[model samples]
Target chain A: MEFILENILNLIGFIVGLTIGILSYIGFKNTGSPTLFRLGIAFLSISVGFFVVWAGYMAEDFVLQKGHIEKWVQTLGIGIQTIGYFFIAFSHSIKSFFPKSRYLRSVGMLPLFLVSAVHIEHILRSVSFILLAYGAIETILSYFEGKKKGTIFVALGLSFLAFGEFLGWYSFVFPESILYYVSISIKIAGLISLFIPISKIPLTKIKFDSEF
Target chain B: MSKINAEARMVTTYRPHMKIIGDILSTTRDDLHSDGGASVTYLIRKANVSHTRISKILSNLVSQGLLEQVNSEGTFRYKISSNGREFLVAYQTFSRFAENFGLVI
Candidate 1:
């Protein structure tokens, strides 16, 4: 248990990946969304996450490469993480952007485009995390507001996303911090949040008064 | 004492249920859902929704007497009236769907 908890990020990523698969099934079976875009996004995010884990967790910290090259690689890796998070959030909630999800086409790409010189060490990293978190929360809220709201599924997916980010980001910085394991704990919270709500939502059709 | 209705089936020369209605009152629906009621300030937050759309929902319900302004002050909150409640009961389709979903209505 201790060993598994310590590597919770990896575990949660695995679990979340599984949850997305299940959600896609349910969406198809129950809601009739018609395609597997949601599942594709979930799997893709998990892959990106695992890729980061490999680069950070398995790669030799001190390589034979030169200083300039190492910094370039590190920055490149962070860039990949940013792209991954953007799409994960996108896949989680397509409803919010309906009739103009086209706007999202540039949402993820723009921040990278306007990477101005006024920069700090991890400024992009920080800003990206904040936006991703905000986006995830927005998606969850939108799901809740839907007529056939499914708070549980959305919450579960968000848990994985938020924790995946926390773990991956924390590991990016700490690579050796004791708090490293907290990422998975965060992911666990996400899973439970989703699971609990899902079981009930299917039973309720958002009873609204004729007045509303 | 009063509530706005976003579901007016009739249109005032605006094609019914077009973006004219959807775009306008989507925000109203959001505000009402979040706060459990809506006001002018909430209407302002629904900046995307046209004043025309909000008027449609509110006025339709008012004409039906489902909503009425409760206060002399302009800062009145909209709420469901007794007629509205009766309408809501019918709208729920609870008796029909409840049986299908296996619930005791």
Candidate 2:
């Protein structure tokens, strides 16, 4: 049951991410906006990341039959996702991930140093959480400035993704709990939320005054 | 806000380069004279841009084959080329898309 659920969530994530990536690419091609270009790469990276994890699950189910996924497979997937999150944050042009205050910066770095002796997967998950959280904050700041309805959805989506990654990191600590499934579900929800704003965009040709 | 205030706010808002290009192309295509062209003065008024800026933009558009310059009775005029129309369409679509993302272009 757990394996099937995991596969389903990852598949959904892959599909949603791929769709967003393609749409962003089309927008970039039309407008030559660097923001759209970055968004395209970001979603594509996220899609590929989900695909990697899903493939890993399939391989485990069919070829390995080990009843468990390899640590490296999950780590690789999360690492790729981290890259995507980085770009998402970068699209907003976040100058610094850490607060400017030296004390606050040290507090932020404390977690990574604390986990340095732990597994590589833990570190990667932490990094993913940090990136997604930063992106979410930036997006929310953008919403505050613009007050666009679409920005709200994006802000919510990024927040969900950040929270999901945070839970994913916790799932590593408690492997037997349901945190993993909840984390995956939230991430999928985040992707869908992000899609909402894009779907609302009209693809039809804009009517000009002269056309009337 | 009153309608006048709203219109004033809109006019004062910043427009990106792509948007200005779209406006120029649309004006040329739609506000043409009997000769199927618009003068620089007409474009300047409609596009709400400075004469010098519009001159540079028109030159660039002509060089890019998006606009055709014609000497109409000793007065220079510009017409939107086929490429310009296609570009305007694409620009309008993408502009709407970007606007949804809270982007200017």
Candidate 3:
């Protein structure tokens, strides 16, 4: 049951990410905008990351028949997803990853020091969380500045992803619980929210006025 | 009074590079009444850009095959090429997409 649910969630994520990536790539090809190019790469990386984990699960079930996925496979998928998150955050041109407040900055670094011997998977997860959180904050700031309805959706989507990543990290601490499934579901919801604004693009409504 | 002031402020604000290109192409394609094409002066006025900037942009566009320079009579004029029309369509589409993301392209 767990494997089935996991596969379904990852498959949804993969499909959504792939669609967004293709749209961004098309936008990039049409306009030659560097932002669209970066966004294209970001979504593609995220889609591939989801595919990697789903493939790993399938391989374990069929080829290995191990009844459990390899730790390395999960780690590799998370690492790739982290790269995607980094690009998303980078696209926002975040001046600093850490919070401006000194107290918040200290709290942020506390996680790194708390781990006695940090595993690669843990480090990658932590980095992914930070990047998503930072990207969410930036998107929210943009919303406040621009007050665009579309930006609000983007901000909400990023926030959901960040919260999902935070919960995912907690899932590792309590592996026996249902947090892992919840996190995956939340991330999928975030992807859907992101799709809403993208689907609403008024392509036909755009007019080139001469008064400019 | 305030609405008029806001409109005035909007007019003075600089247009984005892509917007200027779109304006130039639009003026050449739609605003021109004749097959003789748009003169540099006419384009400069319609695009609201300086002579030097429009010259550079026109040169770039012609080189990219987006615009065709025609020597109608004694003066050179520009006509939007088929490529330019395709580019303009794509630009219009992507502009809406980018606007949704609060990005200018």
Can you give the DockQ of every candidate in the order shown? 0.03, 0.33, 0.29
| Ranking according to DockQ, highest score first | 2, 3, 1
Deviation (Å) of B49 in candidate 2: 4.8
Model 2 agreement with the true structure over B8-92: per-residue lDDT tens digits: 9787887777778989998988777676599888899999999999899999999999999999899998989987887788777
| Candidate 1 per-residue lDDT over residues B1-105, each given as its tens digit | 122233342322233232232222333333355444567455545543456666676776667665554443556655556555544433333222221211111
- Worst lDDT run of 10 residues, candidate 1 chain A, spans A27-36
Q: iRMS value of model 3?
A: 3.4
**Number of the top-ranking candidate, with lDDT as the measure:** 3
Taking all chains together, the TM-score of candidate 3 against the true structure is 0.80
lDDT of 1 at A17: 50
> In model 1, what lDDT does residue B79 have?
54
Model 2 Cα RMSD, Å?
A: 5.2
Model 2 docking grade: acceptable
List model 3 lDDT by residue over A82-195, tens digit each: 888888888877666657998998997887888738687888877888888888788777667567788778778878888888998888899978898888788878877877
Q: Kindly state the fnat score of candidate 3.
A: 0.37
- List, residue by residue over A1-212, the lDDT tens digit for candidate 1: 43346235445554555554454444333322323344435444554544454344334334542322244444554565455555555544435643466677668557555665534325445554654575556655544444333443554456465655566566756765655456556655654554443344333443332333
The residue pairs found clashing in candidate 3 are: none
The candidate, 1 or 2, that scores higher on TM-score is: 2
